[model samples]
Target: MTDRSAFPRRREALAMLAAAALPSAAHAAERRVATVDWSVLETLLALGAAPVAAPELLQFREVAVEPAVPNTITDLGLRGTVNFELLLLSRPELIYSSSFYVSSEPRLARIAPVERFSIYAPGRPPYEPAAAMMRSIGARLGRSEEAERYIADTEAEFAGLRERLKPHAVRPVIPINLGDTRHFRVFGADSMFGEVLKRLGLANAWTEATSYSAMAPVGIEALARMPDAWIALIPPVPPGALDVLAGSTFWNALPSVRAERVLQLASINPFGGLPAARRFARLLGEALPAERGHG
Candidate 1:
């Protein structure tokens, strides 16, 4: 029953399969793309233009939670550190990045052509810039129409939220992420949170100019100045921050804290793109309705 003639053909088929899996200089027309930037990665997901490789999907899934990533993509490793070997194995035809990886651009170019996008600028809100980045990435991926549609969809959602949240728009929202017991980072008008809150027709409580996006390690005492605003406590809350706050006199004395006007929101990446704007807006909408407390 052993057909010896088929043996040679079977071995040849196996060799071809192995070659296809390797990072060789060949393709079936579809190009590979890799990115170390979460913003780029999430934008790609929104456009249905998944990259061949991305970094930190594990953590990204928890924080950004929008336009879900595909299951087939390769994880290049941690976002803080790039895994050069894994990236090489992925054999991306192109690599998309943000300013955070500027120093590594030269090295990245060695493996594939690299394109960098910038969204954060000191003075202006990044909403338009973020949308521009999406359009740019979509053009690169040959998904320009999809990108425009996604941007339109996101804007439409915000427009709808602006109407839905009109009732609870009485008080401004002060968004803060606790760094520890003593201090927290506040989102200013230039920040994405501040920008989204504005788009939703709600005022941002913190009006001071931020250095870039958020001002970190701000003293807790400063919150006492704005008593009527709603304090939106963002998570990744330090190990025992809540218990610590429960026992502190100053924390209890803050009117927002005492009146239970604090809205506990999920982790929304402060530097994300349109998808992030939608995520933050949706979370606020769901949590701001009746029975809104400790959420």
Candidate 2:
């Protein structure tokens, strides 16, 4: 018992001094990540882990993110052409990417522990898949709270939107990715868009099949069945393609077209990721009318 009380106070002071001298606990545990999509990068940032470099999709470079810690977000270029050397030089601890690209590229594993999740499946809806990706990413980052919060927020937003647009919820919606090839794509039961629409209490017009697939090219004749349904356009198409389609006889005859129900959306990134989920919800809200009117 020789000066034990003094020893306790001294130990506490030493601990405080050590903590003060050392970097913060948050900084000590921080991780470096490299990702393909800004959406995924944003999710990690949202979860408090920002990537040192990420692909700046030409269209999405305008996004505003502030307090911009780790400001150097390198643009590694686009799909199928990642700058491996650039990414490797950064020495990221983890690289998050879409499964499609990872499945094709073998060198990703060599750089670091690569985590693959799809955020841009061509014909796939991205909500549940994105939600699942968020969970996986959160687990990897040891941010379980973030994952739960994302899911809860998404569910809450969807529920509120559904309730607000209940009258128009029953209206059938179609997802089409118009392009030079004239790809006719629609979200299936398992797609992210499907999950959002399902959550919003809306119905998918296409019942050809459930799995994501390239729909058989439909001409004006096919529009007879559900002409009154709304058409939701996805992206990657030239800006004027919709105008071209609109002028075409095949597109002009559809009841939905005639009724002006076709809604152009900037959020058809697909691939089932968190960004897709959030964007889908916002797009759905925007696409649906605030108040249903006689059509």
Candidate 3:
């Protein structure tokens, strides 16, 4: 027969032990995260953390090529107007966003801890900010080592790509996204694609100042200015934009188009991090001809 006083002490001991084990058990459960930006989602996936939810997932699939998001994750909504009710129901442990969406931080904090990551700043290279963002997010997600490895691997890959693309090092290339038959968004030095071009030892034909968005909306006449430039078009070009451009005398007049010095890359997120940089490098290497001649 157990004494009542001893029974009470045993119960207290059991409770203490259980309390002590609670933290470890909680740590074992993967943290649930929700990302409000595609870049954050890409970085999290690269770090081996699957977010519980992300915004614009369908659009992300169309633009972002690598580090695919698993179907288990929920789509909260678009960037500007996320479904707060659905977000609450998801019960995320953390919410990651960008500085562009800071207005929603206070509201997001009510549900979970909110972290805002800034990837672009004045007077800094795009890759510098992107690498820093990866490390910062990685440390928060307990993936610091993986983040370091990713940066190192990207650098190694870039070095190899540089050697492989040495023949076209002097070639000036203009990367453009078609907005319509008459206008296109030309990527310049401030863009992620610009950084990739620099890494490959290629020159950007469009030297004019561009918005922080890294691209400038210009008329088709702009392409005519860089007659010696190789035009690289991003895939999934606006529906019928090319067909319309093909008929335009302004488009056919460009020396690049006439010489067949144009390359089309597989879908790549220009705003993504290390994985995107690697993808851009590989694709450009494959697209460029072995010699100075056209592909």
Candidate 4:
């Protein structure tokens, strides 16, 4: 009548049920995960696992190197966005993404277990979040060793470039996503691109505050200030835009522009995971002028 008499029996029954269910729970935890960003996809690939689906596989088609996993991953659209309906249909075990788009859309969790982690956060200084993300994702992917190796290799390569560039006295470098000859977004010290520049021992010309990328748009008026700076154009644009930039006075008048230091890199997501960082190094080295070729 006191009801306390039934509590002991209920606890015993629940304990028994939990003990019986532990094995099934362990099995359920082993489901594979898929990611939308190329960085995460690269991390997973390095970890010896492939996602069920990924967007823009062709962009990193060389790195992925494996045939598509049948009935698993489906390419929905571009990076930073996914087709929710297709995502639901794909039935990923887990979905990984950056903080920007993921936090903006919480409804994705309804389809699968969406693990929210900030690969990069807005307004944070020093850009430590990116390296933290790499280490965290590396641990998750069981490839922390590979991640360390990559980090070391990148640092070494950067050091070599620094030595090569020192003779010429490395100057500030402004990496711009050339929207046009008149307007451009200059990368600040907060971006991965900026970090790559820093690794090469080049200072970022823009010292102003930045949001996510620490990137702010400026007009050609600012170009006059960075006479010794080299401009790295990003996203290797269409032929028409290239031609227009090639012919514009705004592009022609700068010191670095005249010295043939300006170069364009193909559009690859510089944010996200380890592969992104590695790819950045590879792309930068390829785009930069050789020691003999420089002034």
Residue pairs clashing, model 4: 52-73, 53-73
| Model 2 ranges with Cα > 4 A deviation | 1-7, 10-30, 37-39, 59-71, 118-126, 180-183, 210-221
After superposition, the stretches of candidate 3 with alpha carbons farther than 4 Å from their true spots are 1-30, 291-295
lDDT by residue for model 3 (1-295), tens: 7578898889999999998877543333335888888888888888888888888888888888688878998899898889998899888988988877889998999999888877754434578878988998777776788899999999999999888877776569998888778888887787788888998888989887776645546887878888888898886588988788788787787898998888888888877777777887888888887775434
TM accuracy, model 2:
0.79
* Candidate 1 ranges with C-alpha deviation above 4 Å: 1-31, 290-295
Question: 16-37 in candidate 2: lDDT tens per residue?
Answer: 9998998654443445778865
TM-score of each: 0.86, 0.79, 0.86, 0.75
Instruction: Report how far residue 99 has shifted in candidate 3, in Å.
Output: 1.5
Q: Write the per-residue lDDT of candidate 1 for residues 118-143, one digit (tens) a residue.
A: 88878789899899999887776667
Instruction: Write down the RMSD of candidate 1 (Cα, Å).
Output: 7.8
Give the least accurate 10-residue stretch of model 3, judged by summed lDDT: 22-31
Instruction: Between candidates 1 and 2, name the one with more favorable lDDT.
Output: 1
- Model 4 per-residue lDDT tens digits across residues 199-226: 6666777777777774545786677788
Clashing pairs in 1: 264-295
